[model samples]
Target: MSENRIYLASKSPRRKELLQQVGIAYEVLLLRDAPPRGPDVTEIVLPGEKPQAYVARVTQEKADMAWKVIQLRGLPQRPVLAADTTVVLGEQILGKPANRDAAIAMLSQLAGQTHQVLTSIAVRSALGLHTVTQCSDVSFAAMNQAEIAAYCDTSEPYDKAGGYGIQGAAARYIANIRGSYSGIMGLPIFETCQLLEAAGVRTTTDRSL
Candidate 1:
């Protein structure tokens, strides 16, 4: 592994794009079930687990698992980065919609309301696990049933939290956002750079420095 390169333990193309946009060289570390037939990181929220805690825990588990994978495979040692994002409507955590109906329902609840998008990132390094969480408040414009249903019919909502993607067609429906937009997209560039730098992983900014 190059001194500047690290491992990204996420399947989200958005995360990859964000890392690339910031000139962070990373190889994707795909975590898959071996003989266990289960995921390394269970995304299920524990009983009464707060949204913040849930996201943070999941992200940490991912990074930890990625580190273990490196050791198991005898791969070069490097920082493993992972992240999880969720949408919160009050106390409820809105994960990825299961189907079109579910997507419609989630969008209906979010219409004409403000919700919080929480993204937690964790990196496992030789020192230990370093983590950070970014929360962004997003307000949605009022959407009628027809509009909601039409939007849900598209392919964007099913794969994203809160039944929508801020950078997709759903962007038009967003009234405002307060906080890191990249965080809402699943990776906050500023915070990610901080963690990576702290872990001694060089980025484009480091080259300029």
Candidate 2:
């Protein structure tokens, strides 16, 4: 592996695309597909855990687990990058919806409301593990039952946080966004570049430096 490449510890295609967009070469670590005996990073929110805490903890665990996998598999030594995204309305954390009805309910609640999209990233390098969380405020237009149901009927809402993908059909419902758009998608490019640079990995954006 080249020194410019790192290990991406996520299965999200959005994350992969974001890295590719920035010319940050990475090899997918596929943590979930690792050996059955390997540790898995559970997304369960502990009792009384705040959204920020939960996201940060999960991101760190993912990076840690990826690092362990590297040692176990004898893969090349490189920085391990991991991230976790969650949608938060009030104090409640909205994770991926289980089914069509749940997706509809989540979209219904988010309609005409402003919610927070929290994406936490962790990078484990020779120096140690580093993490950062980016919070973006997304406001949705008022959506009618038919609109919500129609969106729920599509496959876009099933695998994404808050039961919607901001980059997909759900973009029509987004009224405004106050933070990093890439953060809302899954990875915050600015913060990700900062972490990768700190780990001695160069991105295309580093060319001007």
Steric clashes per prediction: 0, 0
Per-residue lDDT over 1-209 for candidate 2, one digit per residue giving the tens place of the 0 to 100 score: 25678999988999999999988888998876746335877899999999999999999999998898888888788999999999999989999999999999999999999999999999998878889999999999999999999999899999999999999989998999999999999999999999987887877665677
Query: Which window of ten consecutive residues has the lowest lDDT sum in model 1?
Result: 31-40
Highest lDDT, which number?
2
Q: Per-residue CA lDDT of candidate 1, range 60-111, in tens? A: 9888888888877777999999999999999899999999999999999999
Residue 198, model 2: lDDT of 84
Deviation in Å, model 1, residue 206 alpha carbon: 5.2
Model 2 RMSD in Å is 1.5
Worst 10 residues of 2 by lDDT: 31-40
Cα TM-score of candidate 2? 0.96
Error of 2 at 123 (Å): 0.4
Off by over 4 Å in 1: 33-39, 206-208
